[model samples]
Target chain A: MCSTCGCGGEDASTRVTLVDGPQPHEHPHPHDHTHDHATRTVLLEQDILAKNDLLAAANRHRLAERGITAINLMSSPGSGKTTLLERTVTDLGDRRETLVIEGDQETWLDAERIRSTGRKVVQINTGAGCHLDAEMFGRGLTELAPPDGSLVFVENVGNLVCPALFDLGESARVVIISVTEGADKPAKYPYMFRTADLVLLNKVDLLPYVDFDVDLCLDLIRRLRPDVEMLAVSATRGDGLDAWQSWLADH
Target chain B: MHELAITESIVDAIVEKVGDGPVAAVRLEIGRLSGVVTDSIRFCFGLVAAGTGLDGARLDIDEPSGRAYCRDCRREFALDDPIMLCDCGSADLDILAGQELRIVSVEVR
Candidate 1:
């Protein structure tokens, strides 16, 4: 998590701590007497994430110059992003030199899983951070040194909100939602769906067991992003894999 | 949920702008479509502002209603929700305003 924004940090996750007794607190200095200091408002007109955006542009330029297509995968926790990536690399691995940059609060599990597919992988532990910033991606790209013309996939920390505002300099943005979660997922997280170029409805094979209304889901998604493309796929059963692959190939 | 982070940015930006002295107040122009909840930002600012020069400083937010450009209608209109169709019933649109996320200024004494 960014110390400046308090968004990205190992302890960024939601928590409520209970103190056994009263805790000491910082008080304003009485001798400061800074009051009566002429107050003047300075116009800044500066974006809060200006630094992140600048780094994102740099990452974009660097990747574009090398002819690399970077993809940012976003979703809530347990949306099966890693599963989709595993299948994606397994299927598209032969066609392109695939590289995976996995972002997690604290874990090498996703990276190890990607490595098991016999592909290049790097893991970024955000500690308490909820999203992957461009600075982290820049460092990841530099360290991984992906081969020319290769496909780089950044599996952002399982978050829909924070990551939605962050631009990782990816050529494409894909948001995934599992059928088991709910059909209203898109509507519930409009910002996430609104920014995505494509929404991957993952774990479709389990749709029969779950009451996820496909049409309703599509309808809600349409309201948020009328033109955004969607593909229903079962990463485990290999259903609808061809369409997803074709879409990627076209990109 | 991410308000803590934003409040931190607000404090950090004010600190950077003044460098020294006690801040009187901080003003931000938040876009309605920026996805930040004003209530949450306000709630977090108090805690994040403590102990810093900005402590006890007032936080003011200027929120501008979101507006979008409808490609099909070729018209610009206020947008409360991005999915809302234009007057022409076309969903094809590009957001224009309501995405503003910036600090307009800080009053330092």
Candidate 2:
């Protein structure tokens, strides 16, 4: 036994025998016991937008490598987004290479119109989707063959609500609101106005005919987004096109 | 809506964490001010998770209380009301809470 046990014996003295318990049983082979373990509750603390932000960062890196300036244009239906793009492409026709990525629920009419302007254009049909997401814009960029050192204008699907939540790796996001849509638009849809880098008050030529108030609209927009740059223009008549073009050129 | 895309991502995350284990339920903490519609998320979860490992998994949403801080009055209050205002009758406020959209935990076997 060991000196501590006071048995004066070898290793056998160190072992103690059970008094009344059953004999221990031996397993046939060693194996993992995790199969019968209780299910665990894993706490995953993560930001919901973390994955989307990662993809957006990757898109930004790729766009930067090509030296392409992408702008995401958003507005409600009949806000003259397509018309503004038409004017923009024409105004910047020779100064800088321009490409149009038209997003619509259905129809290639916008793309066709842009094509007639002698510019490379691609149309992405979102089907029933309300907005164009980053993945859609990424695929469109690949197919449109966005020229190196060129400006790419992505006209998002006509909607004020859903489009504000998407980040398409655009250098700038421009929100268009027609004068006929009323002056309370900025107040009613503050999210779009808040996220916009520039707000284009289109169809200004129709201000005299319609009941829209340009001053009130501008005031509301200013109240909501104080730092957001704004342009008052009519895409059809090309009124104030020089200012819009100058802003683009500066960027 | 875009909730389908969010659901797909959530399912992917679950699969990554739990592997091929049977997922019994997924619990999400969605706030009222998260900008995500809870009904749309629930509706899309079933559609996106079909045939995947998370198929038939129950979705449990926990809506936490929201709060806002008044800039003018310098007070904090609950955002349970439709209008975000302070007890001092100041409407100018900045949201302090209730913008959470997260998968806090998952029960898997």
Candidate 3:
């Protein structure tokens, strides 16, 4: 009999052990064990975007508490967002304190342009990053010195795809599609158009020269986002800017 | 793409949880409105998991349906319809679900 346990009946060669030690416990057997086929459903139940959304919500509350109205401006490169901001700042500088948060992959050129307007401006060079997230916005807000009853504009990196997914705690999201670009922009990038609160058809001065259809573009935008407000303006020539300024005044 | 960044985060999370174990499979719940392109995520998964602890692990995605509630009609309906209309033909509605994005669970040996 074995000396380890009283239940031992035979010698080491004759005795059969049902359970083995922890030596190979890590590697389970490959046999057709009944428990192996048992379906164990686990309710992990967690949101991957929950963390980002929580941060965005907190940022929104902070903006509200500080009496700041935030706007996220999205568009393709060379959509004249900088020019529009320059005109807006020049027009509304005396009425309300305005700040611009410029996001670019590299260079502080846009921020320099806005600074000439004599408004509070902060530039975020994403450094090979495509989009701006809530964390970056939160950090930029501190440096931008967001004042109460002020309007804050976040000019997202010049892309329509990734920025649309990120919520930068902006009260409004405006998508700018210039008339120089194709009129099918609203149709091609439906997700961005659908998510935007407003769409600005910039560079309307080129309407007569370029093969652009304003009505067709408006129709496509309406089909995608029925409630989205739209404005047509030419920042370079200062056409239809009074209406834009009035809209800003009301906001 | 942003999916590359997201996949990096997932890989970091997995390495933290399971050091070097043989991960059998991973199940992810991707919501319809999560704005994550499923194909891009899958492509990113393959690229990010290469030569890592999660090599050869299968990715299973569960795409759940979305729902929206109509404030005018006081009812809930599917979000896939052409129009955001309620039973009473009202157009104003608020999205209620299908905005999820999560790594639900994993099977390891």
How displaced is residue A130 in candidate 3, in Å?
1.5
Off by over 4 Å in 1: A1-35, B73-76
lDDT of 1 by residue, B7-75 (tens): 777777667656767877787888888899999988988898889998888888999898988888689
lDDT of 3 by residue, B6-54 (tens): 6765665565555676665677877776667788888988888887767
Candidate No. with top DockQ: 1
Q: Distance (Å) between predicted and true CA of B37, model 2? A: 1.2
Give the per-residue lDDT digits (tens) of candidate 3, residues A42-90. Answer: 2233345444555687789999998899989999899999899898889
Tens-place lDDT digits, model 1, residues A62-88: 999999999999999999999999999
Report fnat in order of the candidates: 0.68, 0.41, 0.30
Residue A126's lDDT within candidate 2 is 93
Give the winner by lDDT: 1
Clash list (residue pairs), candidate 3? A48-B101
Model 3, residue A146: C-alpha shift (Å): 1.5
Clashing pairs in 2: A1-A8, A1-A9
In model 3, the runs with Cα more than 4 Å from the true position are A1-42, B8-23, B31-34, B46-56, B65-100
lDDT of 1 at A48: 74
Please compute the TM-score of chain B alone for each predicted structure, in the order given: 0.91, 0.85, 0.83
Instruction: State which candidate, 1 or 2, has the greater lDDT.
Output: 1
